[model samples]
Target: MASSTSLTLSQALLARATSLHQSSTDRVSLATFTGLKSSSTTTTTTPLLSSSRRAANRRCAALPGPARTRPGAVKAVSVETAVGQAADTALVEKSINTIRFLAIDAVEKANSGHPGLPMGCAPMGHVLYDEVMRYNPKNPYWFNRDRFVLSAGHGCMLQYALLHLAGYDSVQEEDLKSFRQWGSRTPGHPENFETPGVEVTTGPLGQGIANAVGLALAEKHLAARYNKPDNEIVDHYTYVILGDGCQMEGISNEACSLAGHWGLGKLIAFYDDNHISIDGDTEIAFTESVDKRFEGLGWHVIWVKNGNTGYDEIRAAIKEAKAVTDKPTLIKVTTTIGFGSPNKANSYSVHGSALGAKEVDATRKNLGWPFEPFHVPEDVKKHWSRHAPKGSALEAEWNAKFAEYEKKYKEEAAELKSIITGELPVGWEKALPTYTPESPADATRNLSQQCLNALAKVLPGFLGGSADLASSNMTLLKMFGDFQKDTPEERNVRFGVREHGMGAICNGIALHSPGGLIPYCATFFVFTDYMRAAIRISALSEAGVIYVMTHDSIGLGEDGPTHQPIEHIASFRAMPNILMLRPADGNETAGAYKVAVLNRKRPSILALSRQKLKQLPGTSIEGVEKGGYIISDNSSGNKPDVILIGTGSELEIAAQAAEELRKEGKAVRVVSFISWELFDEQSDAYKESVLPAAVSARVSIEAGSTFGWEKIIGSKGKAIGIDRFGASAPAGRIYKEYGLTAEAVIAAAKELS
Candidate 1:
């Protein structure tokens, strides 16, 4: 068995050699240098050898490297030597090793963490941080700084190491030691809220890649909106490091396809193609040509033969990516799994587990690291500190340029500054349009259009585009210029059919821009599921993005069950810190907008109706602000025998039901519940006053599922809702078929009573 295993390994190596030879002349070659015997056959024309050589040659010709040579003649080079020694190769290598040691030590100290990635890809991280990236460490949120994302977030040690070494203010040695502990800056996974340098919270694989695309989109939007011919204020690149697991996620495919379609040239991704995953070798499941797949998505694809030490090659690939201004780029970089450990290196055993004290000591000794655990050499620390200065020079230089730009272009500079700091212009809220009962009846979508126009007039930094449903969603603000490719004057974005990308991009815009502007995106409420992941990130990041989702329910009649949202409201409300508002009338709609805009640390979704709602006589802006209000009181007494509660278009049904109940000798009260999240947030006294424990006979009516309504209406109370998906029919027919009418509400009220 041992001899057979050796023979198989030998055959594999010989095949790799032949493939490398052939790859240079004809096709792209991917060679694995894993268990090869030196005693393998030396025949030059061995099929494997010829194929490998041709493949290798083709790959070399595609990159900006030395001329192709004989397949077996390729020399193994260290990272510093690969990128160029003119930039202090020794210091760079020391910093890279420092990152590796810190990661291993921190993980070992914490007794928890995925250590394989940091150990394997330290060279890539070092190259990007010391040679390729540009940023002001003093200000991690520098407006034009390049964005870096660790898409494989379980390997957060990789990111934490870079943050600390790069001198980011939030990461420290103690933070590293406190990893995975409550209140620690270094959590098990990267969280933007917990750490200053984290671009996005990314543990659910593929999310960070989507977020990187969003960041790139934000950069493009900002550059189009704020950049002048002479001042490229918003130009910056978004870089991401991903692993095999990240590629396996479906969301990654969705995001990458959209990124490729949108032609996000500023987005560059380095795929750590380290053949190993938790399950085993990638060949066990994944075998597609990743490079070809990316090429199909319209991305510029490149490869680095030895990612573990090819720092020069990595740097050159990034530079080449930057020069291509037409599409996003992906560089496939092959690397080992656990780079330095003796027994565990290149194996899954070292993926998540910590090396024991004995093993760690041996590994450190092997690597020539003599210091104690968590101890850094003074020279190494000083070297890295010098590479990424802690001084205020970058900021000071930018301030001078800003001062000069302000002098030359005062209005533009002020607007740009306002946006960078996340401050709304004075009296911007005053421009929010108001609607009265006397106005002509129209769909809530149309009312939204007027509101958008009014807000656009006052808020110069308010930017958003819609999904393909812009016409129906009424999300367009005609007064503002359209955000088009290569157009700097336009502030309004056009996201085409990319709803998921739009949501994620809005998060990026909120993150990239300071206080001056509030980024938003619009689409049908049903489509929110497509962008739900991005919305969660917005809530998690406290990015004040507004999701204007129209076509809120079954009332979106003929579009069929697929377009109708039956359980969306309940699903959205389930998310922590997300406000879901469904307004009944124009006044309440405006109130929802007010609360949404006022919330600077939370994300809000305005679920607007496709049909017009009759203006209620008692509807007022003040009542809407309170989240829920008594639209009508019982004429018989202050205490009502039955309560009819409803939201959105269903409120009208509840109102009619209340009138009928009154005729039946019941003291009925009608309440309009617009925002459940906000209402729940109200004081208990206020809540008790609104619901009143005395009112046991309560009926809550809505066109959606009954999941969340149970909290508002107790077990004894009845809820009238469409518990299942809708069907293709006219709005009125669907309402009748689903029992969404005043009669249904009256029956439910009677049953509860």
Candidate 2:
């Protein structure tokens, strides 16, 4: 079944086929699919469907459409078959066509979107929603159900159609009609937030696969943590359908390499080898052997010669993938882009454009689809009646299994249940470290490790690692073993040097983690550019990822300009829905971690330091939660002449500058601006209290770009920072050379005052 074929799901098929053929009062609708009909034979070679496909279609929610399909319009499998009768082949074809047409109708309605993917990949969609994956439309978050990710997310219409047909309330006909319009459930791409059954926000090429790896990782971890040998829970596969664009992206290589290295047996990716891209044929820019590449990365590769019509091959590939319980599988399925399109098949013309009304009509004729727009034939509706009920039954069975498990292992069950409900253990926050001025000065990175280790003791949901920089990044959870092939129970994950993949993988963990586990990723602050796309996805998808970025700014030293992050702080601060935190000392570091833990709807990037920092007297966890606060003010009992702001290593500089200014008989108020995004979320009155509007004399001290600081410093204030690349030297010298010092801040504050 593969270049490295190991086993097949023959036993699973026997069980699956039996359950499907069992006597049932309910029926599932079927209305669509174009078989790879051979001219040489009378027996149409219906694409081979795997065992998962029979149950797959049973779960399909049917959409009621017009009264009929075209006379002799590729006769569909009838839905009125009796029990024990091999499920109607015609019904399967009809179901496949329904999906195809639904996608076309949505794309046509939107008047925008990539129609080629939906039309071409509908068969695979049917195989997954109808046959492969298992999920209840009523409760899309069922713990043990398989997950399906559409890596080619531009064709979200396909997923939307499946959800609608599969009876998921997440996408109704009205939502489908809205298409890409504002406030629609169906956006330009599949958004997990917008749809219930949607697993992760995908579409940026290789990020989805990385996310899939994360999902599989979470499933494996949970199974190991909670599952007993007799009552197996957390058994599910993470299936991803990726296209040529996804394969071409380098992030795919990073993620897939890890997927193989980790031996994620439940990750089954379908490589949609539709050789067409936006510009033209993929051969123009992408000509590498994907199969060879995956194999080199230690993946089991399978070649499906005729994906369009070879249903048997697709089914068999999945069966074989399931049988191998050690490594991930990549099934390369070659299909024509815009399949069945008389004129545009296999061409880029069908990639992103709406097939014109004329072309649509011609195509409808070409494929024998006579139903009106958004029509789901009734026979199809009847066929899908069993999916919802079947899903409910499956969920009930799981609940019963879990009930038995809970009875035997009370503590384990309670923990698993807590995770599923997104609840932290009682008094988990008690482990956070507090600091006093007498506490020895320490690098914020070192303090960050303390917070991480402390939190690890309390929060089981908190698990993370650095991109091959766990030591330098200080992101390791002490006493926790590494998450490797053999030990999925370990909290620390070794993501190698793949920063981009690490971010994407973290997104997956956040998205699929049952109880909303907070996944964190770390690297030097300077290297964020390498993983910006994944980070952007994390923010966009609301995957509350904690990005523990150490070696912030020139303080990283000796690495020079190439490693100094001059503009990164400003760049990330400008980004929406992310906390860009640069703590001053031990207390602020704890406060930052506290805020990060509380804000589970957005991502947080802690820009920590390489140099030592003394704990400030007035810093508190409560103040950090409020976003920012005054560390020292009105010591002389008069209106402050100037307000000083600082973050990270520069906070000490600002504090020292404030001390010098206060000695000169000027009242100075020092404010710790730890998190810009969090600060912006605070009340205007709160912001004004921290930085009074009446006091125009102010200065901001930070070791990065001064771009966004103007929002706080104002026109009358000066900003002390390094706007350019730094030179090779020790941390202290680099800071001094860049003018990021107490003396420079004092001079700037004096000028402003």
Best prediction by TM-score: 2
**What does each candidate score in C-alpha RMSD?**
14.1, 10.3
CA-lDDT, candidates in order? 0.73, 0.77
lDDT of 2 by residue, 394-479 (tens): 65566656666777888887777656656678887779999999999999999999999998887778899999999999988978
Backbone clashes for every candidate come to 41, 35
Write model 1 residue lDDT over 324-377, tens digit each, in one string: 777898877767666777767777777898877876876777566777766667
lDDT of 2 at 457: 82
TM-score of each: 0.85, 0.88
Regions of candidate 1 where Cα sits further than 4 Å from its true position: 1-87, 387-391, 480-482, 488-492, 635-638, 663-666, 751-753
- Measured by TM-score, how close is model 2 to the native structure? 0.88
